[model samples]
Target chain A: MLSCTGYAARSASDPLAPFSFERRDTGPDDVRIEILYCGVCHSDIHQARNEWGNTLYPCVPGHEIVGRVSEVGTNVSRFRQGDVVGVGCMVDSCRECKSCRDGYEQYCEQGFVGTYNGEDRQGRGITLGGYSKSVVVDQAFVLKVPDGLDLAAVAPLLCAGITTYSPLRHWKVGPGQRVGIVGLGGLGHMGVKFARAFGAEVVLFTTSRGKIEDGLRLGAHEVVLSTDKEAMARETGRFDFILDAVSAQHDINSYLALLKRDGTLVQVGAPEDPLPVSVFSLLMKRRNFAGSLIGGIPETQEMLDFCGAHGITADVEMIAMDEIETAYARMLRSDVKYRFVIDMNTLAASA
Target chain B: MLSCTGYAARSASDPLAPFSFERRDTGPDDVRIEILYCGVCHSDIHQARNEWGNTLYPCVPGHEIVGRVSEVGTNVSRFRQGDVVGVGCMVDSCRECKSCRDGYEQYCEQGFVGTYNGEDRQGRGITLGGYSKSVVVDQAFVLKVPDGLDLAAVAPLLCAGITTYSPLRHWKVGPGQRVGIVGLGGLGHMGVKFARAFGAEVVLFTTSRGKIEDGLRLGAHEVVLSTDKEAMARETGRFDFILDAVSAQHDINSYLALLKRDGTLVQVGAPEDPLPVSVFSLLMKRRNFAGSLIGGIPETQEMLDFCGAHGITADVEMIAMDEIETAYARMLRSDVKYRFVIDMNTLAASA
Candidate 1:
């Protein structure tokens, strides 16, 4: 086993502090990477506090991990030493399932392994996340991080970026299509960039009026303050696709009212409260409400290449390893500009 | 204006009492139908009690209307005296709107006019429904009921029939498809029949095991008791489409979990309470929850023809016009076999 250190939450109420943990040594099919930076996802806070009721203790929660490869197992062909690689929400799956064969390993019939806190195949110990110094994962799940993009900004691409991008790609978002992206934080920001890159007329839906300029800067053709009824009324029954990234409970039906016939609204954010959807909203126009999780390795790599081609990456603020606690607090209040990326150089010094 | 006698709710709590309402003289585009039978719809109860908050006073709640044309306007070409016709939920719509032009007048962009308690284009007064002896409507919204199907049992074909049929047709249900009907009442019965008619393998999922025989009798290839975990597990991720027709809020996520990847569950019933959905379920399978309203006039005519050809009609119990209140109560308790059809002969004798 390889020894590593990461900021860990010992209890639900405990602040993250330096803690040592053990990761398995790289096996024949594994790659060991020094995690360069990790994107802070909203789920990190949710899991750390056991908000969704499935949290395991002593959690080191991070999934949007980007780093430089330090070592590769003898049979690992995907990466070599010093290769820039990324790991998203998943690490492994029972690869024989139909979903895994169909490039939807995230929906593996036997369940895909999560990057952190989820049980491993042997059901031995809880899986640790990417908040630490290094990680060893099977070669199948590792993605090549493209050269020249800001490494810190590219971290969230593993989670938030792919989470939004997967739905857009699955729905075939394209030219002349009107796309509505709900919310304006980490997931929503990527949604805007991806929708724009997909040649869509992107309209950003946000509750915060202050996000209008940022939304526009993120490549939205328009920003709708969702609270404005008149503005909403004007755009009723217009969108072809709506990527709803708002995790908090809100009026999902109101967004449904904005969709054209056969248009779909895909939700990636898991709300703590259940959304009350009016069946009439979907019935009247043949509208659809769907949800998507972070994508698999193949699609995640596709998202990265798409981003690399379009020069798309998250607008991020870099913080040191110890600042995750404060970053999490600010994240709760939606205070972060977009995403928070951990600078792992700070972690090495402290270690 | 002509005076028409019918049953109507003078107040929200009132029973169906004798009332007089006005009918516009046949315009060039008008067709006046003498209603022979009106199917009792669950929505009638909701509107009569103002449960959905859009009820108007002196409401005559019947949209599943099967009637005979008593008169036609000079320029009306679609119908003439003695033609059998029907009216579903919608009565009027702006013909120029995209939805109206696309033959989806039920989803008219300008908000399609309801058959009952909705304002007409001229804004003279709210339009009444076919619970009355006769209704005057624009020929565009009137559908010709096919011959050979029993008129009494075909009334529900105008509403419940088309509501289920539209989604089945839109979702491309066809031969060799595995379709699940989630309830066995008005809409689910129709869904099972239609899916079977479309040459699909129909499966009925019900909370009641007693419905198993009746389900197979209604064209279902098999019946699965939804409460049985082992039975549910045996069919996991298998259905290509699920038609959810239960109006009461329940575990929708459970039904969603039954769908195969990229499958859809269309809700035809309106539950007052919001259904609680887990994002993980939908994300895992790429499943979709959608809503579908009644079909357009063209499609309703097609459905009636389809039902007629298949010898399919609502399993209805005939009742006198005076028994509407008791019938509604029975309908709410699931005491009726499938539908209640008012005998207009009883209406004429009583009046």
Candidate 2:
């Protein structure tokens, strides 16, 4: 067993605290990496608090992982010691499923194992995530972090980045298309960058006037305050595709009306409640309301490479390992500029 | 001006009554038809009773029309006098829009004019539908009812048949695919026929155990009572395409669960209230919840041709023109085997 240190919630009601655990020794196909940074996601807060009602504690919550390889098993040929790598929302999936064969391991029929609070397939206890100082992962689930990108800023790309990127790519958003990014949070910010990088005419839909300048700085061509009926009405039937990143309870019909005929609004964020959708809203325009999870491994790697090529990375605030609880509080208030990335070296220093 | 005798609702609270109205004289681009049969659609009842809150009375409620061409203007080259023709839901659309140019007139950006209770583009008056003795329509909106098919049964094909066929065709449902038809009403019956015709393995989903034998008769390879939890459980992640023809309020999430990864559940029926959808239902499998209106003019024509080639028409119960009110009552109870075709000769005899 390899000793590891991480921040973990001892119970649903407890705040995250320093915890020590053991990771499996590197298997024949495994690559062991010393953690560098892990991005704070809204879901991490949800799981840490057991808001989704299925938390396993002491829960070490993180999935957006970025690290430097320190050791590699004998059969790991694709990576070497000292290589930068990442692991997103999933740690492992049933490899024999058709989805796994097709490289969409995130949607494995038997359910992919989550990075944290998930049953471990390797006979270990519940899997811990990237909040730790070190992790042992199969090479197949580890992604190559592209060169020349800010490592901390690249952390969110593993979760928020891939969650938004998969839908844009799956829908084939590209040049000459009108794309809309709903919300301006961590996910929406990346969506704007990726859509802009794809050469699309990007429109940012937000309720906050403060995000207008940041939206443009992040690559949106236009920002429409979604609360303004006149402005929203002007954008009616304008978007070819919309990426809905708002997890808060919102009337999705208002957004559905913005889509052009045959257009789609893909929800990447899962809210606690179901959305009430007027069938007529969809029927009249032949529009689609779809939802997409974080991407498959192949596409996640593709997104990272695309980000590297386009000079795109999430705008992030650096926080020390001990500040995650405070960061999560600020995140709930939409106080972060975009994302919070934990500096795992703080865990090392504290250890 | 030409006088026409038809059955119409004088007010939302009133039942069908004999009414006299004027239709325009046949113009150069017009074809005048002596109505033979008209199918009773659920929307017809809604419109007649102001259920959708946009009725222009006296509402002559019918769009699924089959008739004989009694006269053709000089510019009407597609049809000669005595030719059989059909007219569906739409009357006219902006010919210059991209949707119209692309042959999807149903989704015209400027909105297509409805056959009844719609603003007339020619400034004649509110357009009236086909529960009448005669109709004069532009040659562009008139479809050719094929030979060697039951004319009465073919009436519903104009609306219900085209509505179902459009989605099946749009989603590219074809041979070796598994298709599910939700509900066992007018539209679902047509979906079963079209899916079976396309050589898909057809499954009919119904709440009524009584419809099991009828579902098999309507070309479904198997019928599953959607209310049976075990039966529905057996069908989880089973369908490639699900044509949702249920207009009543039902939990759509259960059916959404039945779709394979990347599969679509296309809603063709518009219920009174919005349907509640869990984003996780779509995100888990990358499934789609989509809506489709009646097909475009070109596709409707293609459907008619396909129906002709495949010997397809709606399963209809014949009724006198005066029996429309009674039929609408029965339809509300899901009592009709599929559709009711009003025999227009009853109108002529009463006159």
Candidate 3:
């Protein structure tokens, strides 16, 4: 076993604090990563608080991971020592499932193993994620970070980037398309960038008027105040595809109506409650309502390559490892620019 | 205006009684059809009772129409007197909208006029349907009824038939695919027939075990009792497409579970309440929950042609013009197999 140090929530009601843990030794087909920067994702907060009621505490919650490869098992041919890499939401999936075979491991039939709060495949204890000193992952689940990109900003790309990228790619959103991004949060900001990079005419739908100038700067061609009934009504049946990144419950029907005939509205946000989708909204124009999870491994790598070419990186605020609890409070109010990435070197120096 | 006689509901509480109405004279681009047989639809019942809350009273409800052309204006080159023709749910639509220009008049931005209880496009009066002795329709709205198909049986093809066929066609359901048809009502029965005709393996889902033999008889390769949990559980992720034709409020998630990865469940049945779709259900397998309205004129024509080639027609019960009130009561109890067509000769004899 290898010793590790990270932040852990001792219980559902307890705040995350410093904790020591252990990880399985690097085995054949494994690459051990020295944790560098891990992005603060909304799901991390959910798991840390056991909001979904599935968390195993003392939970080490992080998946949007970017790090340096410090060691590789003998059979790990794709990666070696000192390589920059990433491990997103998933670490393992049943390779024999149809989704895995088709390169969509996120939708594995038996369920993909979450990077944190998940069972380790190699008989180790519960998997601790990238908020730690190091993580040993199967080479198949490891991603090579593209060179010349901001490594800290690249952290959110593992989860937020792939989450938004998969749906856009799956729906075939591209040039000459009018794409709408709902909610100007972490996911929405990335969605706007990707849609614009894909040569689509991007429109950001935000209830907060304050986000208008920021949205435009983030690559949206226009910003529509979604709260304005007159403005929303003016653009009825206007979007070719809408990427709804609002996690909080809102009327999805309003966005569903904005889609053109045969258009699709893909929800990357998993609200606590079921969305009351009006059947007439979809039937009216032959529109579609769908949801997407974090993408498969190959697609995640593809998204990274695309981001590298497009010079796209998440707008992020940097914080020391100890500030995660405060960051979580700020995240609850959506006060960060877009994302908060923890610099894990502070933990290493403290150790 | 041409005088016409049809049975209509004076108000929501009133049953159908003999009423006089008027239709526009045959204009240069119009064709007059003397009613022969009109298929009763579930929506006809909904409209008569103002179930949808959009019905105009004194509603003469019928849309699935089969008739003989009584007269054709000079510019009407498609049909002449004595030609067999049919009319479905729509009478007229704004010709300039993108939906209309693209041949999907049913989704016209300006709204397509319903066959009955709809404002007349020519300023004559509220448009009466084929329940009357005669109807004047735009030449473009008239479909040439193919020779050798039973006219009475073909009447339901205009509504239920096209309604089911459109989604199957739109979703590209074809050979070697597994298709599930929910419920054993008018739409589901047609769905089974169309899926079979399209060379797909059809599975009919019904709550009643008694429908098993009838389902197989209607071209379903197998029938799954939807109420049988063990049976339903055995078939999870078994279908590529499931056409939900059950208009009654039921758990749509159960059917959504039956679809394979990337499978779609299209709702053709318009239930009164919104279907509470679980987002995880769609996100898990990347499944789609969509709605499709009745097909466009061109696609409806294609469906008719396909039915004609495949020797497909609705299994209908013939009734006199006065039997509609009793038929409506029977329909509410799911006591019809599977459609009721009124014989216009009974109205002529009474006159």
Could you give candidate 2's per-residue lDDT for residues A1-351 as a string of tens digits?
112532222333432434335547888888898999999999999999999988866777889999999989999999999999998999899999989999999889889989888766654566788888888888989999999999999999999999999999999999999999999999999999999998999999999999999999999999999989999899899889999999988999999999999999999988778899999989998999999999999999999999899888999999988898799899999999899999888885445
Which residues of candidate 3, in runs, are more than 4 Å off? Answer: A1-22, A349-351, B1-21, B349-351
Order of candidates by lDDT, top first? Answer: 2, 3, 1
Model 2 lDDT on a 0 to 1 scale: 0.88
lDDT for each candidate structure: 0.85, 0.88, 0.86
Q: For model 3, how does the per-residue alpha-carbon lDDT over B1-351 read when each residue is reduced to its tens digit?
A: 112632222322332433344436788988889889999999888888998786765667789999999988899888999999999999889989999999998898888988888765555556667776777888888898888899999999999999999999999999999999999988989999999988999999999888899999999999999999999999999899999998788899899999998999999987777778888888888888989999889988888888788889999999988888999999999999999999887775434
Q: What's the number of clashes in each of the models?
A: 1, 0, 0
Q: Quote the positional error of residue A48 for candidate 3 in Å.
A: 1.5
Residue pairs that clash (backbone atoms under 3 angstroms), model 2: none
Candidate 1 lDDT by residue in tens digits, A1-351: 112532222323432434334457778888888898999998898898898787766777889999989889999887999999999999889999888998888889888888887666754356788888888888999999998899999999999999999999999999999999999999999999999988999999999989899899889999999999999999999999999998888888889999998899998887865577788788778899998878877899998998888788899999988898899999989999799999877775445
Candidate 3's displacement at residue B61, Å, is: 1.5
Q: Report the C-alpha lDDT of model 3 over A17-43, residue by residue, as the tens digit.
A: 343355477888888898889999999
Chain A only: list TM-scores of all candidates.
0.93, 0.94, 0.94
Per-residue lDDT over B1-351 for candidate 2, one digit per residue giving the tens place of the 0 to 100 score: 112532222322432433335547888998898999999999998898998887866777789999999999989889999999999998899889989999999998888988887666655566788888888888999999888999999999999999999999999999988999999899999999999999999999999999999999999999999889999999999889999998888899999999999999999988889999999899999999999999998999999999899999899999988787899899989999899999888885445
The candidates' DockQ values read 0.57, 0.83, 0.71
